[model samples]
Target: MSRVSDVYLIAHVEDDVGEAVVTGALEAAGVLGKGPGQIKQHHLLCCSTLDGKVPIVRQLEPELHVDGHSGSIDELKRFLPHLLLVREGHTSAASGQTNVGIAASLASYFGL
Candidate 1:
């Protein structure tokens, strides 16, 4: 029988609130199962944006497996077709880690 591929939707949050949002979404998505293989997630945070969410996804040499190849989200999309943008919230000029229930709402929207 053919193997069923897993779906991955990453939620890059700004702070604790953001992390909580993502955690809730993931849990609500019905318990994450093991992927086809080990998938290492690397979160790169920057301050260029007001919310401090990095737009680029990078691969590290240290995390590379002999059978694995380096590629961006666009490249990965070729293999994993579905893409979902769950949540996106911005912090106010003076607020720290604004309440951005991004992933939670997104996962709900997608019927996760």
Candidate 2:
């Protein structure tokens, strides 16, 4: 987490996730650098609202945005500088100005 300028858990509420559960999961994952209070909880769109997260991603302007949604990562990578898609059976774009990568899980990706 220290490798990046900033991080936030911007998940769509309807992602079948309750805020408390999300906070607990993040806390358990040890990814909440500053703690759950620092999370930017936004409740826009459903779990599949890929583009709905664009604004938060844009505002944060992170060097990399890691997400489990392949489609969102694919599209957001076009604008964001770097992206990490955390899922199985996927690869970054072969060629593009944006930088994209893949990871099997958050623990492995961050070496947590």
Candidate 3:
């Protein structure tokens, strides 16, 4: 089996509604299978455009084994080493933590 690298990009939605939009985008892009407990099993890369979402992403870092998180593509691109583009939304009304899980799963699948 081949290992895949998990990569996730987060965007703030117009309101709190962005969480679903972002999640859908990630899922559509092939980032999925991240439940709650699986968070600690893989490496994660997270990118977001919302300042408010940063804290949420940060909170998930330890759980997902997050290697990097950035608010801009430039920062994420430069710092992440490997990059994956996800949907766009502003601040998730629900929770963006799942994004980290998605990233981790993808990374593990791709061996990144």
Please name the candidate that would achieve the greatest TM-score relative to the true structure. Answer: 2
Q: Which one wins by TM-score: 1 or 2?
A: 2
Sorted on TM-score, best first, the list reads 2, 3, 1
Global lDDT for candidate 1? 0.32
TM-score of 3: 0.30
Q: List where candidate 3 sits over 4 angstroms from the true fold.
A: 1-9, 34-49, 61-112
lDDT measured at residue 25 in model 1 versus the true structure, 0 to 100: 57
**TM-score for each candidate, following the candidate numbering:** 0.29, 0.59, 0.30
**lDDT (0 to 1) per candidate:** 0.32, 0.62, 0.38
lDDT of 1 by residue, 1-112 (tens): 0033222334445667776666565545534333433222222122233222213322222121111112232243333323322323422121121221123243354356
* Pairs clashing within candidate 1: 87-102
Which 10-residue window of candidate 3 scores lowest in summed lDDT?
90-99
lDDT, model 3, position 8: 40
lDDT digits (tens) for residues 3-112 of candidate 3: 33243434556644565666556556554445532222232233334555445444444223232343433333322333333333322121233233223334453456
Error of 1 at 44 (Å): 13
Off by over 4 Å in 1: 1-8, 31-56, 60-112
Best lDDT among the predictions, by candidate number = 2
**Candidate 2, residue 40: how far the Cα is off, in Å:** 8.7
Indicate the residue-level lDDT of 103 in model 3: 32
